[model samples]
Target chain A: MSLVTDKIISKPKIETRDLGLEMTENNRSLIEISNFDFFYGEKQALFDVSMDIKEREVTAFIGPSGCGKSTLLRCINRMNDLIEVARIGSGKITVNGVDIYDDRVDTIELRKRVGMVFQKSNPFPKSIYENVVYGLRIQGITRKSKLDEAVERCLKGAALWEEVKDRLDTSGLSLSGGQQQRLCIARALAVEPDILLMDEPCSALDPVATAKVEELIHTLKDRYTIVIVTHNMQQAARVSDRTAFFYLGKLIEMNATDQIFMSPDKEQTEAYISGRFG
Target chain B: MKRYFHEELEEIRSHLMLMGEKAVESVKLAMQALLESDIELANQVMESDDVIDDIEKQIDDEVVRYVSLRAPVARDLRLLFVAIKASHDLERVGDEASNIAGRTKKILAQGLPIDAVARVPRMCELAINMLEDSLRSFIQEEESLAYSIVGRDREVDTLNRENFKELVELMKSDSANVSACTEMVFISKSFERIADHAKNIAEEVFYLLTAQSLKEVTRGK
Candidate 1:
């Protein structure tokens, strides 16, 4: 043991480095939000929110109740506009480098490019085939052959074709909770949206059904830049490439899914994920 | 409910600590058995291996249950995972201790002069100290100490290598000393592996603390 050498050796110690908590760099940002502030009338809901959601990647927003993860998600598609007092107090949000709030922008056309799924699988009381083609129909796609093709393609894309193909005429509500969610996904896919915003899409689902939607989310990311807001950290970890943590309207941390779930840079993010506190 | 999960996490830590204590005891007992040529103590060390194995099984079962039922995340998730991982390494350490004890019985049977194997006990003490410290780091959350043990593994490896080199020279120098010297080399090898196990525990503690693999963090360093 007394044999000594000139080779320099440094002892390994777990040093606490100043882990830079910021938006994780991606190859490209399909949607970039910079200093975006949101308010519901007098109350500011978001504070200088900034993030880059990459192209054709699943990015999940996770936080505790009232963390405003959902609020930031709603900004992606202007879903917050439904609230009468909702308004952007500062900064800009751009989808594909175009300001979504531009006067020249068409909100309906923007929605067509950015389809959304909600917490509840709100499939209209229509036939399964009707539900899948609801968006196309709204765009005035009346051709039966075109609608028929869209139904098969989108349902298959959503992993629901094998389950619901036979009962094309069956009411959308007739499907199970998981199947209903998949149907809602199919309906969103039918419009060929470049971005998909899912807000707690599996909160009302059973495990098996939740798994199906999660699997669908994995498959859907190849074609759409998906942003999902999930209270279920496991689901977000299971489905997304990147994850963003928001707390009390502040963007806490965003990194690769494994990084966020395993060792988040921020103590707040770790506490929230570890269930220490929210 | 959250308190319950943390309690389970604490329970797993306690189990690992118990397992670590037993495993470290085996190392100390095996060293004693080798130095004193005590056949009874060697056999006792070998027989008690089942305790470590049983604890390993319990940790595994509890981990599966914790993962499936609790759905742990972040530090909670890392703790559960590291519990299973560290227990496995401790079990291996137990096996190494048993192997050392088995070698002690062989050396004692040959009526070998334990003086030739004096260096092996020193190595055993170093390895045992590292093992005990690794577990202490985990139980006490002295995270830096655990990582320091990881870096110290290189010293163990060097000692084992140098001892082996010296033993092989002794075997070649005198035909009569070949058997005992060869056994001494194997014993040194076992100590090396035990030190490796200690290093593994240190790595697990790093992951348990930071949710980052020690190897990954140290790779750049």
Candidate 2:
């Protein structure tokens, strides 16, 4: 017998764009995964993971330490390509109906379309304008007017234009921690990525800074698909439209953020959300 | 990690059980006052009603505190929701006990007449048993036992109905018996309302267990 069976199923046919189709107003899915598995050398990091990332939505990954939430976030942009021993086995990851892992897909192009921000404020040691336009410079776009326009547009998009516009030529490190993080976001936006992946982006910031970043995230989802991995349950509840809980390399539960936080179906998910255990 | 909300919830449960016990004792004492024509027991039931009222306020304050602070959900939410309801029922039980005490006072002031206390005492016993069973079902989370108490409501209903008819017949047979019969009717009505409140508590227990409204269940039945 085949391991997978192709069963014929029928669902109510609804038009995607019809206003009268009884569809939810937010009806776009930007990414979908099916039975995805990830491994680092001999050890499996993710098992049978499947979920969807809706466009213009904030999806949060939350779980205990070593639960592979960060690993799963990396899979969206193939960040694991930088890890020598990491491998994907027996699954598919698609972004806007394009298979990301296909041989024909250019990894650089993929990264351009899917940007990422790290936990720390990793602003390069350069002028603020140069940091925001670094990706364009790497692509050999040397027009000064174009770089200036891109800098202004990206900084404004990141809600950092007012604070940094006066100091565009100053060193990126001169900004405060929260400003630096927003600068990193501006840098990511400069690349014009369709999706943004943040891995514990506010874990190192103070509460005030964290609140600013969280509010920025909530605003950013109007333009970019956001996938964030956070260990803070309250942060996940506050920011994400949907949340997935991972446990020991397995995807235990995934649902709307309210359901996940307020009344999760799985007992383990409930315990974790209720702070019974990590 | 502190789980302060869970601790507060447990405290509410303990206080509700304590209040339930006090309400039951008040009902029993008021019945004793009626049967023995003892004004002292009647006064005790009235005094204890104040304690029940105090605990009801305490439970209400704790529930509001937990809701505002923790925003408890799922089973915790259901527990708190039912705690608020159960406290209201217990307070009303205390009120019913006070009402019974008032009836006892009136009957004692006017004198018990002659040989007419037996059926009222029996009806009081049945109503108190129903109240005790209902509270037990609530504290134990026993839905089946709660359903059985729901079944027992009909017995109390029948007793109250029959007792009402018997009192009316007594007043008709002797016009001088009107005042005492009227007092007996008031006492029987209080017992009937107590049974109704006990039934309501049992239904709330069922809701806490099943998440389905008891009103819906009876409508279906």
Candidate 3:
């Protein structure tokens, strides 16, 4: 109990970013949550969670089942708003310094800038080309050249273009499970979201398919900040630059991925990583 | 839920412990043979080498299977990696013990004065002690114990150097004792390597426990 191993890297202060005195990447807090709490009707699911998701970096959340990792990711782009029982209790979550839970913040608009991919590949039954551009079409982008370009670019971004380019007219459901997941990722990318949240994107795919997604994640972080929630600890270690460990609704630790995997600071982190946690 | 994965890790630990005891015993027995000139004991140490090798081979295979199955992370990860390297070091330690015993075979055949070769056994005692402590340090996950074990490496090294000097002086003064002196030097060198292997395991234990290399830590006097 006396071992103080929680040697996480310190978060940057908001004032430092505002004043422009500490403008280094280490001091950048792309998404900041301060003392945030959430509830599902009577039961509180998150307790005073405060952490930063840096710009253009993949931050993975890992923990046991029902540890609120998915719950926390849902709160980022207001994905939990669909659940009638869910409610935000207190505190502030700011993306680009604007409080997301504010009254004027449209959930739909917020989701546009923060794309998401789910555990299952939920690609629409529409054709693969249509699935890629479905978001843009709904937003009223109708130009043939624009939709065609978006389809090409996003499919390539997901690394599915070469395999599916000749079959663009085929139903999205016709593709293999891994390819369908990549199609969902392309759909998410078509919106040009600054932040992408993935809730166990590779959970349903085989190892070969999983590797493609992980490799895609590695490249996607250069243009968009990504946060992933995965129970797969090795996948989290492989793709993310930083890792956050959550347990029992609390943010236990956040650190560089290697540090988290090789020599984490918290005993709970150690226990979880070592498969000793009960 | 207690997964079978944790059980696999425990199995690897137990096997490593068994190998540790064998490695330590090999050195002890070989040292005894060197001091007492018991060719039979020397032969026993040599013959037991395969048992030590087999234990290491078993642990190596178990570690590989554990990693392939669990893909262990953090401390479990460090434990697997350290287990692999430490097993290799333990195997080499066994080989050195056998090497020392092999040299003792020659000394017995030549009928040399065991006194001139006596200091090497004294050095083996420190090396054996270090190896024993290194194994304990790993089993207990004691960083401080491993560090203390690392610091003792210098002592064994110093004794090996001094022992080598004494044997060289004996060889230079008496041409007839040259053959036995040559075997004594080889034994002294093997003892130094055994001490090094012990230090390697201790450093590995430090890494396994603290997740920091012991050499990086500022040692105390």
TM-score of chain B of 1: 0.94
* Model 2 residue pairs with clashes: none
iRMSD, all candidates: 10.1, 9.1, 9.5
Each candidate structure's TM-score, on Cα atoms with residue i matched to residue i, is: 0.58, 0.54, 0.57
Instruction: Write one digit per residue (lDDT tens) for candidate 3, span B1-221.
Output: 33324777899899899999988888999988877878999999999999989988898777765564356789999998998999999999999999999999998888776567667756888888899889999988788889888668787788888887888888888899999888888888898999999999999999999998777685532
Q: Which ten residues in a row have the lowest lDDT in candidate 3 chain A?
A: A1-10
Model 2 residue A132 distance off true place after TM-score fit, in angstroms:
0.8
Error of 3 at B111 (Å): 30
The residue pairs in collision within model 1 are none
True contacts kept of each: 0.05, 0.00, 0.05
- In model 1, the Cα lDDT at residue B15 comes to 92
Q: Which ten residues in a row have the lowest lDDT in candidate 3 chain B?
A: B1-10
Which digits, one per residue and each the tens of the lDDT, describe model 1 over residues A121-142? 9999999999998889888999
Q: Give the lowest summed-lDDT range of ten residues in model 2 chain A.
A: A1-10
Q: Which consecutive 10 residues in model 2 chain B have the weakest lDDT in total?
A: B1-10
In candidate 1, residue A196 scores what lDDT? 95
Error of 3 at A269 (Å): 2.3
Candidate 2 lDDT over residue span B1-221, tens digit each: 23323567889889988988998898889888888888999998998899999999999887775664355778788888988998899899899999989888987887654545656676677778888888898788888877777766677778888877887888888888788778878887888778788888888888888888877887898
Q: Per-residue alpha-carbon lDDT of model 3 for A161-198, expressed as tens digits?
A: 99999999999999999999999999999988878999
lDDT of 1 at A209: 86
Q: What is the fnat of model 3 with respect to the true interface contacts? A: 0.05
